[model samples]
Target: MKNLQKILKYALNYKKYALLNIISNILSVIFELVAMLLFIPFLNLLFNEKTVIVSSLPQFSFSKDYFEAYFNFTMNQYIADNDKLAALYFVCVLVGAMFLLKNLFRYLALFFIAVMRTGIVKDLRKDIYNKILILPLSYYSEEKKGDILSRITTDVQEIEFSILNSLEMLFREPISVILSLAVMIAINPHLTLFSLILLPITGLVIGRLGKSLKRSSSRVQQQMGVLLSTVEETLTGLRIIKAFNAEESSNKHFDQQNSSYASLTLKMTRKRDLASPISEFLGAMAMVGLAYYGGSLVLDGNSDFNGGEFIGYIIIFAKLIAPVKAFSSAYAIVQKGAASADRVDAILSAKNPILEKENPEILNTINENIHYNNVSFSYNKSDIVLNNIDLKIEKGKTIALVGESGGGKSTLADLLPRFYDVSSGAIEIDGINIKNLSLHGLRSLIGVVTQESILFNDSVFNNISFGTNNASREEVIEAAKIANAHEFIIQLENGYDTNIGDRGGKLSGGQRQRLSIARAVLKNPPILILDEATSALDTESEKLVQDALTKLMKNRTSIVIAHRLSTIQNADEIIVLQKGEIAERGTHSQLLSQEGIYKRLSDLQTFSN
Candidate 1:
């Protein structure tokens, strides 16, 4: 119920529809009760032989004048005119009309319930997607993609059907039960009180059983997330699985996760199923008790208790059972929905670790210099990835970062784009700290190409124009030519329109890398960061890409992270890093003369060549 309160806050905005549904449910219950009670008068009219008027009853008696007045009016208007034939026809017609009206209002109530149900579902999914888009990249590094996807789809669907729909039933069914009970008590208080005594016992059983269901449901949802994440990872790396011939190993891993999920689901289902039969059994026992007591009172010839009223009491009691069943079932659904709400809340309540300061300045363009002054950083309080790094690049100069792996080469490149902030220092473009600049403005001024080419499942033209929405076809083709991608792109089945499958899988590795470079070229930023852009290509592809890279780097303030020693030989200056510190800094020829780490790296590459 607490979880229901939280979800209702979002649903509260559509109160008009909820109110209308409530009114319709009330009307439906009223009409249904009227239909059930109509049988009392009609039965008395048919069984006139033993029909006991109020004045004729021995112990239970009314004043003769009042009883005669009511009796004469009923006989003259209804029973005496048509006898049993007329009474039976009248009861059938009246009951049928009441039922028709009840069903009509019931349909209208459910229609509005559907509106509120789907509206809330739509709003929740939209909010979750928007939050995901605004969340920091660092957030993704610590969470699984499949878990997030499951929250948006499976978890949200659970809330819609189980929670919202259960609320609709909860509101309508309880009202129906109450209305039916009122009619039952009016006819015979003794039977109504006897049946209601079983209610507290049923409540105690339900309370105890449902106490653990919410906790178990939460565990089930979490296990499902794990299974979904495992399947996602397996699909993403299926090629590797086949290449390594690890099919049996992958199947065993999947089976383990699948079996765990199955066990949790079975447990949750057992807990949910417990509510139904327990409620029904209690209701049936109450009915049996009523039948024995009411039959004995009628057989004793007590004029106070007549056969027709007894029959009406039984019909009303039967109506009460359905709503009681619904109440118990809806309670179970509420528990399941509560579990899902907690998962969604976890994602929505998470605070972004990286955010812009208030009233941040916007930097439109860079003119003077890009400076890294005593910059240091660490991720998650671990060993420093960068330490007191100091460097400067004039507006139009090429500075190459040459270092071994894990030497913070790519980390430095990432900072220039503000993908991360320095832990203890500042990075500035044109003397203004980048942290002070608008995030959008800071990213718009730089372009990046990494070792792994990041492209989507789209046409070649869209891939190149991804960063520049208004780029013309001619501009796109020119950027492709500069990236040495035009020749292969035009030869495809659909030329620029050809679909590059997921992650550009339909293209070769070199082709994908060139397309990434083309995307950067189309963006045409003042500062470009090439992080080992040619390291993954073969000799011939590297030569072609290096030529394209030379064309792209011309007149741009470029930061190149080079792995191949020969690639940075003509760089303006090369900095060699060792364990988050600069070990050597010089031109290629001067570094060779120093006979240090850079020299050894160059010699090794030379021998390999």
Candidate 2:
């Protein structure tokens, strides 16, 4: 029910459409009642059950007595003057007109609902997309891309199918049942009362099936998430799979999930499909019982109804069955819809942001320095990744961190941008605690380039000017030249306009890294963080990128996670990290003279090559 309220919040945005749909549906129900009751007059004409009137035609009035008396008198007058055939034609034509009006209003009602449902789908998807963008990076690390995508795709679609489409029926079907019940009660109150008694019993049976359907629905949706995750992993690792010849293993895993999903879907279908027929059967039996009771009264002259009137009562009673059956079916759909609503709510309600305080100081520029004061960090809280770390980086100087692969080098750099907050202590910029600074403003002063050289499937120009969308062509070309990327970019098929395939696949590793450097150059931040920028390239490629890196690092406050010892020999300072703590701190020569952890790592890389 809480999830349902959340879903309703999205619906309420277009409340005018919802209200109009209800109004239209109410009109449709009224017209349908008019059409159905026409049968009563038609039955009287066919059976020739005449009621002689000594009084003249009653004046037209809003009262029920006037309406019933006046309409009967008019029908009888036509029968006496013309013939039964003319009167029957008039009633038929009247019924057809009422049906035409009913359907017209129903069409208008459906039109409004279609607009609302489609709008809600578009806006809801947009909201989820915006939320995913603003979510902290750690959220992505902890959650699967496939499952998040499934919530936006499959689960949202389920809500559209079972909830949005059912909105009209939610109003239409119930009002139809109510109006039909009213007419039946007007004709024979006792029989209507008897029929109403059977409904709660039928509801209990349908309600049990609805609960079972919801359980199956939730399982099916969960299995779909797992299946999506499998396919996503397979696609992302297709290259590795082919290299290792693990197609059979992948297929076996996929088959297992697919079979499980199919079984759950089969169960949900059976449970949902069972509700309608069961309700319909129960309704038919109640109608049969009503026939026995109502028939006895008519035959014994215990009721005012003649044979035709009794048959008319049965016909109206039968009409009520359709809406009753629809109500049961709707209950099943709502159950399925609720399960989907829960999935969507999970994403919207997620608390992932490294929240900033109100009235946080705007940190638009870098001046004095950055400070890490006795900082310790953990991802899961059970294992610390960086422990008791303290470092200072002044403006207009370079500091290089060197260590093993998992020595918390990258994690320390990440703190500067607040990608993950420190579990203890704090990082200060100049004098103010970084947590007191606006997140957007603080990140704006920093630039980063990583070993992977993340790029997009886009044009070369767009890739270079991604964050700086307003960058002029001259600015981009200059940035490229500084990073040594301009020469190769000009040699491409379309120069700056060349389309780089996924993750810059169309370019060499050196070319991709150069573009990454060019992107950082364009941002032109006061502070730059390079995480092993040339570690993945060949010797020749490394030389090309390293030269570009030297040009990029000149006269800037830079933090370099040096993978190759030779590249950072001239750093202003060197800090060596070992297992989660700083083990050594000095110049390159100073570290070598210490004969410590830094010296051993430097020797291993130099000779192992």
Candidate 3:
């Protein structure tokens, strides 16, 4: 329920629509209330039961019963002067007019509610998207991709059609119930009290069901996140699944989750559906009790209500049924929405670890050298991955990192861009610590290209010029030519306009690497970080990628992480890492002269090739 209030705060964004919805719905209730109350006078005119023809209008009073008696006198005056047929016609026209106005306002109310419903959905989704963008990359590492996606898509949709629409019912339905009850009490006070007493029993039954609904709804939402995660992982690894002939196993896993989701959803729906009938049954029992008790009062002449007023009181009580049921239904929906709201707020409320410093230095370039001063890092802090490492690379010099797997080569390179901050110590560019620099400005000076090309499902032109927001087509072509990608790109069906499919699947391995280089070239940053860039390609593709990488690395301070020892042989300095510590550091030739780890590694690779 607290979550519901928090979610409703978003309704302020589209307040005009909500205000109109409230005004129109309130008008509808007023007109509908008048319409229902008109029945007593209308019934009197038709039956001609109250026949004392009054010469003047009845004096109004402050009492709650004044409107009831005043209207009764006015109708009796008309009935006394006119024929029975004419009086009946007059009553029919008034009843029809009241109903017509009532429905018209109801339609207008619905129109404004529809606008608010869609508007709130749109705003919530946009907020989720914006939050996703600002959240640190580590958030995705700890969180499930599909769960985040489910919150953005399915959970938001549930809030829209189920919860947001319930907001309308919450406001409008109570007004209806109040108006109907007020009229009933005026007509027959004793009968209205009899109906009100049984309401507590109805509330207890519905309240129990509502509590269960929230728990079941939360389970259903969690299962949906898992279900979507299965589909997402399956799509990402579809080729591996097919190649390994594990389709049946994957299908079995998915089916199990799907079945659990369906079962949980069934439980929630069943619990929510119980509210209507429980309230309805109890309401009907009270309605039947009022009918018998009110009839006896009219027969014994112990009450002010005659048969016509008694029947009209019952009619107004009957009108209370729809609004009471609607309120019950809306309550159940709000309980379910609270579950989803908690899930959504979990992401929205997360604090980011990689935040920029206040009044931080803005870096335009690396002037002197990039220094790693006693730097160490760990993914989970238990086992340190990069130990108290100290190194420096002068501006415009290429530093190569070589090591066995899990030696933290990639992690070391990642520290430069602050993808993951060091567990201890600090990294600095020139004289300033990286932490003291603005993240965007610090990263703008560096470009990264990984082994697995991270291209989007877009045109080659757009992919190449991705971050260079104002890059021209000529610049894209020039960058491509420098990376040796222009020849292949121009041969494509649409050339620069050609779509790259998912993750550049439309291009060959070498072509894809070249496009990555082209993107890095266009960004034209002063510092470049290459993480096993040519490791994934065959010898032929490696040669082309290596050549393009050489062009991209020209005059740029570059950090190279290479698995193949032969590719980085020309680096200005080579650092060899063993386990989580740096074992050796020097130029390739200088390290070879040492005949230590570098020599052994170079010998092994040379012998294998």
Quote each prediction's TM-score: 0.89, 0.96, 0.95
For each candidate in the order shown, give its overall lDDT on alpha carbons: 0.84, 0.87, 0.86
For model 2, residues 1-609, the per-residue Cα lDDT tens digits are 689678867778888988888889889888887777767766765677665462578877765467667767877788788887888788889989998999999999999888888988888789889889878889999788888888999999998998877777877788888888887777878888988998777788998888788788889888899999899999889999999999999999999999999999998999888888899899988888989988998889756777776888888778778877887778778888889889888888889658898999997777898889999998887988999998988988899999988999999999889998999999998878999999888888898999998999999999999898699999999999999999999999999999999889899999999999999999988889999998889999999899998988887889999889998999999999988999999999999999999899989988998
**How well does candidate 3 score on lDDT at residue 430?**
86
Off by over 4 Å in 1: 1-5, 46-76, 181-196, 290-307
* Model 3 TM: 0.95
Q: Judged by TM-score, which candidate is best?
A: 2
Question: For residue 342, what is the lDDT in candidate 1?
Answer: 81
**Cα-lDDT of candidate 1:** 0.84
Clash number for model 2? 0
